[model samples]
Target: MAKIAFILLCHKDPDAVIKQAQSLTAVGDYMAIHFDARAPKAAYDRIRKALADNPNVAFAKRRVKCGWGEWSLVQATLNAVETAVEAFPRASHFYMLSGDCMAIKSAEYAHAFLDQRDVDYIESFDYFHSDWIKTGWKEERLIYRHWFNERTQKKRFYAMFNLQKRLGMTREIPGDLEVMIGSQWWCLRRRTVEWILEFCRTRPDVLRFFRTTWIPDETFFQTLVRHLVPEHEIESRALTFLMFTDYGMPVVFYNDHYDLLLAQDFLFARKISPEARELKRRLGVLYASEGARFQISNEGQSLFRFLTGKGRIGRRFAPRFWEAESSLGRERELLIVLCKKWHVAKRLTARIRALTNIPCIEYLFNEAGCDLPDLGGIQSSMSKRHRHRRALMRMLFEYYDTERLVICLDPQNLDLLEDFCRDRSVSRLLEIECQFTDAYLGGHAMRVGLAGERTPKETLNRLLPTIRNDIVHESDRIRDAQFDNHLRIREIDPPDVNARALAAFLSLPEDIARELANTDHLFAD
Candidate 1:
């Protein structure tokens, strides 16, 4: 009977996943690996052969052709968990993780930590009534029926976003259960795993509903666990540390994250690329020297102390990383929007491009599948968008000349940029972020500086909701002389303000939304 069973959902890199599985063999922990059904035959064969000799590791009988934000991801995870449980009935815990995840702590240390804790570790938040994730975005995930992308097998269904915005297609939350959203990765006790398997078998309707929802993987397991178990029995923080780029994408672990990874108290770290072989080697060395009991070895403790400060490593460094900056010559000007409102971002980019020769290289997050053209280097590269935002940012910084860069971070991307820039000295760079104040912007929401440049902070505040309204509604009425005159005379109070409030204000009309939806054909050629 295995003490721990690791269920790994792998897609891109098999070698790293195999190494991760190897690290768990200290106590004869079983592992069930599920390769994506769509993965190339060659890649799948390589993984199978690599683990064929190991009796403890098994391949999932049911492989899923998984897609992001689709039922397939959930299906794959379920299949792996079921396989692991069936294979090792005496396994005390099931650790659900991705191929990209690497064990930072030794297996003995992890088991010891889990042994002492009576609660399941899974990050969760009130998906129904929480301000943690914006209400509009959350509702969109709840109400709208997001379809699978035929091409890349992802949740890039722009049509759903458009229809939801235009027609406001929505369904009431299930009365029986409250929706929960969190990190897809979690470690559950055998009892909890069994309950989940049983809950899933019985609740086909819930599964069907989440089938077409955006990023259902983040919600399905979390919602089920919250429903099945007592609130006190669950620890909301999943013991994994993940970093994000300034653009809210996952940051792939690299050599620069060496100090950060050592400082983290998390048991696992994720999205490590093959390039970080040295870092991977260090982790492998760390895990190799495990004690007989479920605790860190003396060597492990020494390594921790040597890497970090005098005391034991704490959770304070969980979401931090050294900035990977370049000393290139070109003064790169970046206008980064949290991308809640694509049209506003596009318009802002256009305005900036027209005003100056300063290149307005923009990364727009397209929630709605409007086939927006790449206007003057403004990109809608969903392929690149899907990559870890940190990796993407690193790639950008490495490739682009960003010596003197100016970035505008919206509310969502602000913290990400802070973490990404923590290790670098950005004396020449300026970061502009939107903040709410009592002061009004043209009878609308209170505003902050535009793109953090040297402009008068008060004057640049006018570019927010007003510019947002203009782009979202596809109307210049707010930009007209009459609107300006009215704003000067009377301050029209804005509604409840948020990062996405501007997006919600200008609801898409049915005709326009449908017409824009039709334009998806533009990219078909």
Candidate 2:
């Protein structure tokens, strides 16, 4: 049997924190918690009281003022890990977890699983070579000193970087240090944890160097572990299922993810939102069983069927939808405009609206027709930007009563959109390539009714092929007659006829007009 010490970093939702602690402690494992110093005293007190009776649980003596992408996050982890080690020196494994993380497997299963592997389960990748961050951003993250918390001073820093680039000023990582960046969550051997703590104590310079690094929590441990442990001894997969949005925000898990969670081999899932009560309950029930193998729920079975091509959409459409966009505020208007000016975008949007009435499109239609959104009010503060978008997404999700959404985009938007999706955290949206069947038709237009998820392969492949084929084929034909033929089978207005009077649709401000026009028509006909 493996004795594990869980080091948890909790910042919010005291109830969820208490439950997670209890769940772990119930397994007879030791846990040490570090509540964010910035969190309210009442929240911390509540959590402390909840775990006060558990002898297996301990609290960090010194709490850190945790902030996103700040050294404080790394410090918090260090504090908790140190506390756990002190409380349970005989523990064989130390798992670093977030407040929202929940174990999907029983303690016995986790221990048995770990017993089979001598390697440390830690996520690490070379900063320069990894696609985890944007292609060229590894340099900016590792080279330049990130002085301020990204949530607050990101825009100003970006502007400063741009100015530095113009002035030919550059920074480089120290030659002796190899930069490694990856997910912060990990399960490491006690020896590895001890080595990291020792390194922090003896080599204060490592901590100092990382203090100025962006999201140091991600890179600090990874860089240190890479130096301390042999390459083969470290496992790249953390065994924590964290789904990131297209915008790089961690997707909030909900009841709908219940089936998906059952299917994953991951032992834990992180950053669960407050809304996931049923998911929490289901997970609790799942862990009640001693065996690792559990029956999948009917909903899970249905979802798996849908994902594997037993449903309307085929397997060619990836279950992971990547919404690639360059800017924050372009999507809604872009989709609406495309629907009006282009035939394919319009038909797709119409069909989606008719079938699901997804709130995002409906909200956009209502707002776009009335008045343009005040994009100027969106501040440069990274926190404010995300809060604004999240609010909008929340409203869309709440009003629609569905998590599934279509990210209307074009080929040009792919890379940026992908970056944006990961940045924003759009985990629940269905993954499918968006494309038009025909060329852009001006105001004199036809509403070509496109086939839903059931169109023939020859035609559907021509219009919206799998993302793999879309990238390779690179055909420039603005219209696929085969796809148009399928659409024609459904009642489509004649090419010369225009059903929608889009003359009153809102126009873009001068600054962003060029961006809209420059968008590639490559994805569609």
Candidate 3:
């Protein structure tokens, strides 16, 4: 029987780590946890005390202060491996994991599967020949010494690297090593583990070279395995389900990703969000007994790619309904109501809410946060900013939820309006030419809120000519039957949108809008 030893490198979330260990421990695998040295002593103690009764569980002999993209992580891994090797003498293989990682399949199934394979499972490719690195510090990482955390201590880290570059203090790949880089996670046999340890002992020069390299945890063991281990004895893939963004940050899985993950046949998945209780439950051994039996769908792959994909702009945005001028839900179907007055915005948003029974936002881009029905669908700190709005839009659509937004594109919202009109392929734009109250023209009403660079009146002054010309031209196109399905605009101007007139103007199917308009006040939430 092949027993597995797990090297767990944990820095945070002792509670989650406890739960994960309990699941794996239930299947009789031995585990060695290396809590980060810099982590709070209380957290480490908590994890240790919680798992104290498990004989198979042991803490590493040494805990090091680990940094992202630093050699300390590999050192921590070695610490955990040493402890596991000593604690579990019969262990035939070992795997690298983190506090965030959770076994997707049952540990017994994982052990059985790995027991049958003699090859080491790791993702590896020639660093010079491959484009595995999508962003930041490619060859420069190896050429220069990184003495600080690249992300947290970015300025100093880069300054030192730049200074080294200026001095021409460069080095080559150490020894006969074929430099390989890929995911940091791997499953190694005891033989391979001993090979790596022996190689480390004999190759102090190589160790020195990688210790200063950027994200050497990704290359150190990977390069060693490829250089020393036979090609056939290594499977150039990791068992862990992992993916990275353009900035090299792992995509954090949430409750909504339950189906997407269950479909992929991987032993474990990491970078799980702490809020993903539902996803954690669903991915547990109880839910995935047969070890992810579902086939990986092409749509799932596209959805994953959609996370890191570029934001569409101009004609590059291919929308089935409306141009979002956003990233998340660019092609999602949407309904946006636009008017000049607050009263108009309220009436439109309320009527739609009454019709859909979903309280839609009243003033989406208004500097002053206001919602008509204000059901609190999307509450944002910078609601007026483009990035925040785009993310909210994505959440609404991707959550299988409905959205009914009423944007009062009063002068203050010229930037948003400009982007919307520029898209041309609109999803749904409900336009109402409501005249401003005479009080505002006479400077009697309060100037309300101040937006960036200009007041509402001033913004209107800049937008009037372009909007007038475009609306007229588009209206003419509507008259000439040039109104395409994608640019779905419904323009209506009633002297007053009294309930009866508003319902008729809405033109909803089965006279639904009419009924809702009539009884809106009675049934309104």
Candidate 4:
């Protein structure tokens, strides 16, 4: 027995208005749509013509010239309410909405919910006592009435307001009714709405006073509903989910905010961005679905959180915020293939690609003169490689999603070893050790190396041991990390890469594992 009559106050985007009208359609339900009179005649005609076939759709016969913070906005809404009330006498409730509003939940959910609740869903906080009015004239709006629109004729409007202020001229509200204020959107029980209309009918002096009052749409019904319905019968909030900027403009929902919107318990959301076609398309489907339910309120969540992503965010490990670093890069697709010799690495890469079709790239860190043992250049080279590797995982995931590729690292370069060892994208590591060559100095140790930083003999004797120790330390750190530690050591030493190590490293099929073991011959001298 709970049926809704939707009263839509719309201005722009006739196509969107048509869609909004379509969404309001249900058995025994009605829609009374009103477009701004000053809006283009062509758009208004289009909306009417499109809905001509829908018997449930009705439109306001008289268009009202609505403006921001103007009385005509209230008149436009009143026009819709009058049309809906007269046309659909059986409609149990009247829900006011705008063209830009969208249903966040399924229609069935809304019906089932409204069937159980006869209370009027509106916010009617006592205007003077509540903190609802922020950064605007409160009692002043009603006490001084002006016809000039604050938006369209701002200079004249403010000048008149200032003149009235200086003259100390004010008018009293027509009655002793306490002013109540809240959001303009609401869903009222049919009786409550009828009472409001009756109140307006008998109170001609009050209606005349509101004809020029600043933003009467917000206060008129809000005050009337509070008086007609007891405090317990009125739910002090609207059915529509609305958010505002610091300047009181409605926060427009975009495509990226679908999850945040879906998390809200409210039936509908207001002020969807015009460009959010994908979001509209998605929500259009959701409106018809029966099982969709939004039980939580996501008002406390920051906008950036939804803008950034819809999924899990935080550290690489089982991310509870307090214990780990705050990071969002979680596109960890592949285990690492660390090898010094490109030829051996190439063979391994080919074998993996052949078996799993997982693409692999090699010789990344070894490129920028990193083979030199100059300590200063080593630091500089690490910085450059870090810069290069920063977006590497994200790009790989973008190009080749979950079933993607591998990163080949040079184990000889301590920078590559250190960076990839702790990298979140690198799941685990398999180091293919080949014959260690002094080929940089033609099988001989030089007294002086690149940039005159360190000789080959000096590096081999002093730095090599420390570098080895550093690699061990990093590997140990990775294996023994408190969380998200995916380092598994499967050393594929050439000429002796057994089946056990291959099985330990890759979870590939049996035949692929055998083929990977056979790739050890590529490292043979």
Candidate 5:
């Protein structure tokens, strides 16, 4: 059996780690887990119990609490590598992963990819030129600068910052080679790990510098790789591109195009639930068949139902609205309802626009019909009747801008008002509704509904700060409103509202400028 040692530094998400291990074990692979020593004993025990049946698995000796820009994580990973090498000397490759990450490919394909490379597959690219010595100095400077700006002790912080800057300036001229920085995830040949161990053991200066440096994990590995094997090709992207994210934790998307079997090949993985297992099995069988490979025929019709069935009943019933709209195609009027009740809508719109190039006309109900032409006949029975009229006005204005007549339908009136959008020239009016009935009824639920084991509370807490920050940075009018509210609210000792208003003012997006005028937590309980 071709041996491959998978190393994981787990803190949170033990369940995810266990499920990932189960997937790897199913594919006949050896695994090694290192639970963070600082994590709860119950968590450690749970992980240990989960992997107890697998003879190939063994726990690491020492655990470390890893912090960003800290060296302890680097040391812990190094220790894991050393331990894995000793236990599985015949193992051809070693893969490093975090507790939260997941594999996209099966073990067999993963091994084949690594075998072809023969070198490490870790992303390490420089933003500047290769010969830029200042890059290294600047990286070091940035660490201290961040510390000084954010730290509590003013005098001591500046003192250390100045001292570091001076030392960085006087440090020996850096080599023609540049620092290689990339994703922490890497698949390395066993020989490469051995070579790295030997280099770290003998290099006293490198060791000494890493122990004190702020960016130990990134800088240490980068400097070491650059100095040792400058010519080796390192993969610039994550092996599993599906889990990649611009901000926040990496998330996996299970789609028909992606092969679920390949996920077993990943070095580290988050969990796959029972629902995902069924989906994977159905997809695997569908894809495995010869006739299904050419095209999704009548014979494979059951596959679509199997994959998209279960809780996607509403999706099955609803028409494919998104299918007709091209991302780049211009529309006459894109009417957007900035509802006072859906705070998550504001955040979701900003996030969507940032990720995709989609554009829309955002208008609050209060300001909707003021400057815009009222095409009339837009009414709804919802608590906010005036808001629906404003939505109609906004849609009318957008229609004028696009030179295409389009209608905006509020959720309350969508079913009854199909005639408004039935005209060939009229673009379809899209309604953003909550698929999760439980979340919809719960006032505190995020605008974006929860999916698979995730609670509305957790999702909202994670997303709210980002939404608030984006809104504040995008709008100055909101800032002024917040300032006025702060003066008035603080006098009455209403700190919570004041703080919330300030946060909203600072973070509300410019595109949703009219939305913040109400200053109420739309999703709050």
Candidate 6:
């Protein structure tokens, strides 16, 4: 018979560990359990007693404390694999599982599946395009921004820097290599397992460096596999379809119930608290029913079935829902204004642009509505304020038409636009209010009245023409409003300054406004 080694490195949760190991007993498999040496002796003894009846079980050599974000977990895993290989030399494959992982299907099905693959089943993925790197980094930085939190800031910063270095980011940057990330849980052929162990042995210093590192469990195996065999066949998705515990148990979902010694399902149906005897009674009924093999109905009956085991019967089902794609190609031209300093708005805008492909035209406002210099080109300047606004305006009008009119906004200054439009139009506008305090990680309040009823595409389409008409009206209003007021404001005291600034700024409208006005451009009309 083909043999498989189930290697598990566990700490603290011995009862949970033994419960997981016991499920494997049905398959007549051999297992190597490495309980961290640091665990309490009484706890360790309890685990040993639980598995004493199993003839295929053996204690692993040595013990190691596994710390999250530290390399000790990886080390313990490596140690367990070595011991398993030594004890089960005849085994064809080795599956690395956690104390929390439960087998969803029968062991026979799992074994057959692995045999067919003829490759290690490691869940690996390209990390370069991960949104985690962006959002996680931003969150970490924000946590460090408070003046009172200098000590914590230094620690997190160092951790990030160390992580960047270990992933081979030293000196000259290479374009070909991408960071690999995945769940540490995986199954590997015996040869693959041996190769990994041998590689780590050959490079002792590399292992030593990662020993003190943070979140090393995720990186250590990934880095080693990438370095050893960069083109190895690895699965990019998880193998099991079971719900995992926060502690990492992969509890088996059985169809039948034996006398309620243990309930091994992804999730327990009935509560087993306060009254153990009653819980056992329900479990006995469940076990006798062969794991309650029933399909759930479409009308939220699955939750009821899974929880109470008393629900309307029907076939299994999943709901259909539409998920929005990143706005890569489709972007409306936009002009963003900010009441705050340019730097604050620039960072916010960069994040927004990264999230969406929307084109942006930015403006900054002081007490007076005088035009500020373009700051886009200068690295030291926050806003891209140096670019020719007239050129940008022409591009927006020429390429974009009614299908895509520009978005003009002061995300920080909603007051300026309050009187600019009618109450209804203002109501339709999307106003996102963000908090600026460290305690509150900036809450967003979107004022999308009737627009909320429409899909994003429809909302954009409906709003575009209204924005174009408003921009033209505003340009005319600003010029007319400034004719006499120019003399009062010292910035434009010269008679020619009013027309000159407005002419340069409004040049594109003079050319395209009439063309746009003549066209039947309203979305509804």
Candidate 3's residue-wise lDDT over 1-525, tens digit each?
677788899898889999878777766777899999999999999999999999989998878999888999988998888788778888898989987887766655676779787999988999988999766668998878877998889999978988888899888776577799988889999889888888878988988898889989989889989988899999999888877765667888898766555445577888889999987877665533645344432233433553334222233234334334544443444455545455645665666765665436656566456532322545444543444555455554545454333344543343454445444224454544433333332231223211112224433343345334444443343335322222221223222234444443344553665454444332111
> Between the candidate structures 1 and 2, which one is better when assessed by TM-score?
2
C-alpha RMSD of each candidate structure in angstroms: 22.7, 18.2, 17.9, 20.2, 18.7, 18.6
What TM-score, over all chains together, does every model reach?
0.54, 0.58, 0.59, 0.58, 0.46, 0.45
Instruction: Report the error of model 4 at residue 378, Å.
Output: 52
Return whichever of 1 and 4 wins on lDDT: 4
Looking at model 1, the pairs that clash are 158-369, 249-389, 432-452
Error of 6 at 411 (Å): 26
State candidate 5's TM-score: 0.46
Candidate 1 overall Cα lDDT vs. reference? 0.59
Largest TM-score belongs to which candidate? 3
Q: Mark the 10 consecutive residues where model 2 has the least summed lDDT.
A: 481-490
Question: Model 1, 367-419: lDDT tens per residue?
Answer: 32533343323334655443334444444554443432223333333334434
The lDDT values for all models are 0.59, 0.60, 0.66, 0.69, 0.48, 0.45
The lDDT leader among the candidates is 4
By the lDDT metric, which is better: model 1 or model 2? 2
lDDT of 6 by residue, 72-132 (tens): 6777888788888887777777777766444433455455557776666665655555453
Clashes of 2: 24
The per-residue C-alpha lDDT of model 1 at residue 96 equals 82
lDDT string for model 4 (1-525, tens) is 678899998889999888877866843468999999889999988998999999899999799888888888888888899999998888898999888898888778888878887699888888889898766688789888687988889999989989998999899876668888888899998899889889888988878888878888788889888888888888888888887654556678899777667766688998799999999989888877877656453432233322233223222434333314422145554567665455667787777777776666566555554322223332246455455454444444455545445767754344334444454554556666444444432222222221122222332343344334534544444344432323322334432344445555566665667677776566643
Alpha carbon RMSD to native, model 4: 20.2
How far in Å is the alpha carbon of 114 misplaced in model 3?
A: 1.7
- Look at candidate 5 and tell me the lDDT of residue 499: 40
Off by over 4 Å in 4: 26-28, 295-525
Question: Where's the lowest-lDDT run of ten residues in candidate 6?
Answer: 439-448
Q: Number of backbone collisions per candidate, in order?
A: 3, 24, 3, 0, 17, 28
- Cα lDDT for residue 299, model 5? 14
